[model samples]
Target: MIMHDAPEQTVKYLSLLGQQFPNQQAVFTEIINLQAILNLPKGTEHFMSDVHGEYEAFLHILNNCSGVVREHVDEDFGDTLNEEEKDNLCTLIYYPHEKIALVHAAHQDSPTWYKRMLDQLITVARRLSSRYTRSKVRKAIPHDFAYIIDELLHTHPDENNYRVRYHERIIDSILETDSTEEFIYSLAELIKVLAVDHIHLVGDIFDRGGGAAKIMDRLLSCVHQRTDIQWGNHDILWMGAAAGDAACIVSVLRNNLRYNNYEILENDYGISLRGLVSFADRTYRGGERIDPLMKAIDVLLFKLEGQIIYRHPEFDMEDRLLLDKIDLEAGTVTIGDETHPLITSDFPTIDPEHPYELTPEEARIVQKLVDEFTGTDHLHSHIDFLYRHGSVYLVSNNNLLFHGCVPLNEDGTFASVNCEGTWRSGRDYLDFCDHIARRAWRDHDRDALDWMWYLWIGHRSPLSGRNVKTFERSFIEDKATWIEPMDPYFTLTHDPACCDMIMREFGVQPERGHIINGHTPVKTTSGEKPIRADGKLLVIDGGFCTAYHPKTGIAGYTLISSSRGMRLKAHEAFRTVTEAITHNADIRSETTQFAAAERRIMVADTDTGTKIREQIQDLRMLLDAYRTGLIKEH
Candidate 1:
């Protein structure tokens, strides 16, 4: 409504369209007079218009003549319009036409007023659609967003409705609940099991889920209907989409099918679900129509919340800013009125997996997308980067968060973490960890990768950048168990270094405090072994996130306390623990499809495993390194 100036150019073009149909019959007959015009049989017509009886435009048009909106425009077919054509392509439809069509619609959401318009348009377009070439039809339509119900059926929400973010991590119960209501209902159960105060989101809350719009509306309705939310990758993307950012839009288009501009929507113009129905309604009348509402449900899911669930136990402003930095890199920023970013820009398309180098134009586009990436804008947020929301780090009173180990000089002495809090040892430990985490993401940095995985395997020399990426393949694929040095694509395996870095950089390491973290998804132990080669490091990321595992359960998160040390717990209140864990991974029979329970990080338990203890030692190495660093600096 705020954008309703209907620019002068739009007025001029709309006037021209009206002039084309001077008389009511000129408009009405376009439908019934199909056979002679578009090469159809005697029974059909073309150029249908389900006007809102008054010949004036109304909101009902969004539903009545849904096809050919901005999102669904195709440039080549004469259906797609440029930025200018988009404003100028309005038509004159009478309300009466849509009311009569009501009888044809199966659901009530297609109100009586809109139905009449649809019915008439369907009859006319089918008969005459043959006459006009696709080029002409495309030019006439301008935007694809007009076709709402049409594309929904064509895309077949049933097939495209699988998961995207919730892939490998297994969380049962998440897939069963259909509506947002059901999702919220089960969420409480997941939270109880996980043991968190509030959920954190990374961003991207739109464009890939059922009832995405409604879910978003509900999430925002905290004051309206009262709901809790954690940002996710999709949410920030939605912000950009709603604000109409072409960069973010294009990235999503390349990935998703339901909203792809080129392949599915028949144009690179924009989205047009309503326009799709109108296209079908006119082109193929009386053909079994797919359920548009069902399709809309899928469209709504891209706006889901609670995906990255981070909670803060307690902290001051200065510390919060540090938290923001980690989230920014993770791509979970969330600033209001912010445009979505192009994820492919700053980060390599596949981070060393890219087949070809990008040209300047392509690179610019990527940069534009990445530039607009909005990190969290919350008063408490510490980060300031591109689009991010879901990815979060909690700093509870009892828990500490850090990324790397204390630094080690070329001679292999220790460098102090020197960060903050009582017992400042954690701070020094944190620094060395930082070095490894960064190294792990770098090329041929086996040491860092291995450190993160808590595995002490040495790497072959001259590990090429290409080879480093190859080594990381298993780590990214998350099948570290089956991974071997021979596979060497660059191991996603583990980098004990990252944890140390996070702690020292953010000062999450405390002398006497426990720690909680995400990011590192490696099993705390391997075989029955304890190889504490490098240093003492502790990693608690037992793979609580679905982005890693298709079958990761709900309670992968851990809790460490001096009273009983640390233990694993489930996030029972998180709607579908399975859905939460799986993120969007396919959830077949949980029994057969899922296995390999990543053990929770446990301290002081017989089952803690040698790797866990080894990790603890690696964490300690960070402190030692930091201390040495302080000594050298002095």
Candidate 2:
């Protein structure tokens, strides 16, 4: 056993652990189990970022494990299955129920087809389950077919004729009972479960696309797979809105409206936008007034944001307060010596003397919206999931996952930002923000809710490095004023030293660790690569949102890290799910090997492996104590 800090510490811990183990046999059994687990292959981790509410695309990727299923099919079937047959099998694995229906409709020999498909599924399931322990696989198996799957997966036909007969008996029984469909579905799900051990949603699960709620539902249902989310700026905005922050609510509404995804608000979460919609229609009713209505909501969002800035002076976001600078008479807003023409000058709700103050009607609309945001049960449950399973950043298995920049200054040092009253930077700042975000949800503190709003768009907010140029982009004609300078972190990402500094700051090994970032979509068409700092950092937001597909020229990126190595999969834009189902069209993906290890990584090399080793050490000490008579065995 490796020597620890002190022998006395081990003695103390053994005394405590003795209560559970009680005997040498118990301690030895645990040690044996842990030792066996350490030799198992490390499970694959699927890292996705900037989903932006493209539920169909996101769900498809999750269902297919970013083409891992097809890869497995090729590996297992080889020349036996043709390309078209493989595609059909892959689709069945992804959408089992639908694919089964399609197969039934197409084939007249139902019994023969079911038997053949079942054979193929068991083959795939057996290969997928090879990396995991029998105990783990048994736990993943559906309760109804637990014994049957266990027998099939473990009992090899080559072992003996008896084993072959046993497997055939199980298959024959399944077919006789007409349980083929249920068994196939269970096996497909088990294959998916074994394909990826964990899912890392780097950020931006909401916005732009129409299916954030659907995506969340999928995540929630995957009980067997461990999932973690790093909160993105867009996610934080919605979180703040759910906490009843008016600024956040207004920002969410405006963003949804801009993307023509109002259904996400009204239909998905059941948040009533009737009051705001009515106000917009009634206030801006002249010809060509829809644009004017959007502008009014945009202005209201700015005012609401300004109110938060006013309340928190230490946020250093005074520059974002542009509402008071609008010269309604000139039909222009002067920004830094440039007076740009407004897209729409009508502002029936703003008070020029007190521009940030919402008029009675505007206030009523905002209050109603806030009530809907806070009162909705589904929104609360979704936000609760986010708070429970997410953070501003996460460091897992030597990789640093975050939604945005680490908030760096021009000098490439961590930029300090006010967290409540105290200033923090780097990991400290992120930890504080994460704590406050959870507190905002748990206690519903007004101060924490405001901070969440700050995190949504504040200049120093790591999640929102660029100033949200909502006002200027909406009202100003000059594109120059609309420029929101990116935080220096984005530019510094190419520097190995900068990447090392970030990794070290987050307490991960600079040489071995990687910073997985999202938010800034990688414009691959513009020659911008996702890999930075010679592969030490990866910016993986490859335009999951259709709004960004034109700019990014790709669907998105999924970084798959398994026992073998790490690879980045760049996918083309996904067509509708209907097309994928009807035509068996899969998202075309190109895989680029990012990093490959000299040897396959085992469980002993993983974070969980570290814990298992520690437990083994403790058990050893307990055994020593028992033999030495220092602790009596039961």
Candidate 3:
């Protein structure tokens, strides 16, 4: 792990490692050999950051020729009793010395991805001519590879008609056009054909679009085929919502299964639409239960993961393991974890006996989402939930990583009030109108769960309880002044354009990374862009499926790094910021202008010119909306 193993050799080894192994064990074995051949003093710390779901990468380091992992091939090490061998099996791969430690790191804190990759490694080994691990060492067998179709509904739905207002967005090569619709559709298609070594979905497979049902169906089919990498919160919201609306959903499920030629007896199958009722009924059958209580508590703490929903079988005061597994305390809900947040009585429901109150519509949405998740996925409360005990702390490294907010809670309060408030760093703000929506849905007065908090942290509603100007003004009074202020839904695209503004309030290292985030919704889709909040931040949320277009091949992200310097680039889908902004702006201008023209006719100062002007206005609106939203110029 010595930092200096001849940078050239290290680079060459990386290249070979990338090529030689299609799984983790093979790669790690190579790493072990490489370290031995290099013969560097042991104990040097080597950190593998964010390996993610890269199965081959994992394998390449674990089992390969003359590679670098830990100790391997007892024959290669000579079986000589050395002090290092006596102490640690892993460290014996090297010369055995202090000042060196090899470690692996991930952006999101969860070992589920690592475990899944480990499974893939085992699978690859099993399929290969040579075995990577001894037969005695094999403890687990993977069922299948994960095939995630992100934003499935947003993709090119078979039902899509060539009805886009923009000429460039008319089907073929719409990736270049400027519509949100196009962006989503394009991401969906592109992900299916990405060049990455591996692909995985981190969650949010539903909501905010007309194609929710489509995405859901596609996801179900995909899960049936591949491993479920990330079970995001949107999935939980829907599961919760479904619980209150299972009757209709169950009917839909039954119809869908029947259409697929899958027959069920007694309507109690795991994949049944009435799936939720039979399951819920079992968990709540008066008193005694065979499964963990979380299995029965599916109606609360809704979640989706491992292609299943884990509700409590029934509440048990002594069974803390089930409760601990439920993740209601303070852990971060990353892509792989199996825990879920608890829907406690601490938060009110719409019922008269509930702790809090909610309007009818808000109540309905929550009920529907919960039920949908549990019924469809069999919501399991057995997995760990988000922000249970983990505190949020900001890191100076890794491109100034921060969730959308300024690291503060939505109520302008200290974020660490609870485990949920624990941020690594940075703040969390309630986006525009989501807080209102949350408030409407929740019995007002309940602190939001991580799912709701995550959604509103950066984006705002046009009707959020607070105003943007006022929100921004708060930052002027304290260290918090560095944060942008906006109510729900009020877009902040233009705020960052007023010359340059400093992002770091306190001092940071020279190596401190640049800031990057995913929160703000897309602006005009054409090229030229408007900088917001003085350009201190860049929003990378291309409405990423779960919102507008889930399954389209138009999804990608902005890459920001100090090593790369201050620049933004899109991958696979939209190619650049100018393309996205210009497209978005053009459409908005057109829509605004058309609405105005329609009204101008009634106020006609000059009736003669009014009709012609209105027609032009309508044309301009139609043209501009297309011009902005589509990525045609790309």
| Predicted model with the maximum lDDT | 2
What is the alpha-carbon lDDT for the whole of candidate 1?
0.27
Largest TM-score belongs to which candidate?
Answer: 2
What is the per-residue lDDT of model 2 for residues 1-634, given as tens digits with 9 covering 90 to 100? 3234437876677789999999999988888888998999899999999999999899899989998988999999999999988988889898998888877787843787788888899999999899998889988888888988988998775745899888888888999999999999999999999999999999999988878988888888888999999999999999999988888988888888888887888788887766666777778746643465686688688888888889889988888877788888887777767667787678777788999988887888888888899999988889889988999999999999999888899999899987767889989998998888888877777789899888888888889898878787776667877788889999987999999999999889987889999999999999999988999999889999998989999999999999989999999999988888879999989999968988989999999999999898878878877877787888
What does candidate 3's lDDT look like per residue over 1-634, in tens digits?
A: 2233336754454444335453444444544543332222111111111122122222222111112221222323445535343223322111111101111222421344223222222222222212112221121111221111111112232445432222223322322332323232222222221111112232333333223343333334332122222233233333323332332233233223322323221222233324344444543433422222223223232221101112211111122123223222342121123332332322122133331233354345336544444444322221112111111223332223333334333343222312233322222322222232234234422233323322322122111112222211211223333344553212332333211111442233223223343334343354423123444444444443322223322232333221113333232322222322222211111100001122211112222224435544433333332344421111
How big is the RMSD of model 3? 28.4
Question: Least lDDT summed over 10 consecutive residues: which range in candidate 1?
Answer: 44-53
lDDT tens per residue, model 1, 1-634: 1123546664454345445544434444443333222331111000111010111111221212222221122222244345433222212121222322332353533333233323323323332333333333333331322242122112222445553222211122222322222222222121121121122221222333223333333224222111122222233333333232333333343334433223222222224434334432343324223233222221222111000111111111121121122223454322233323222122222223222234343345434433332221321121112112222132433233322122233332332322223222223343333343334333324333333322111121111111112112211223432233231211211234443443445444533333332223334334211111122233333333333233333213322221223222222112332231223211111111111214422222222223334544433332333333411111
Give the higher-TM-score candidate: 2 or 3. 2
Q: What is the TM-score of each candidate against the true structure?
A: 0.26, 0.96, 0.29
In Å, residue 282's CA in model 1 sits off its true spot by: 22
Steric overlap count per candidate: 234, 0, 200
Clashes of 1: 234
Candidates 1 and 2, the one with greater lDDT: 2
Off by over 4 Å in 2: 1-20, 158-160, 289-292, 628-634
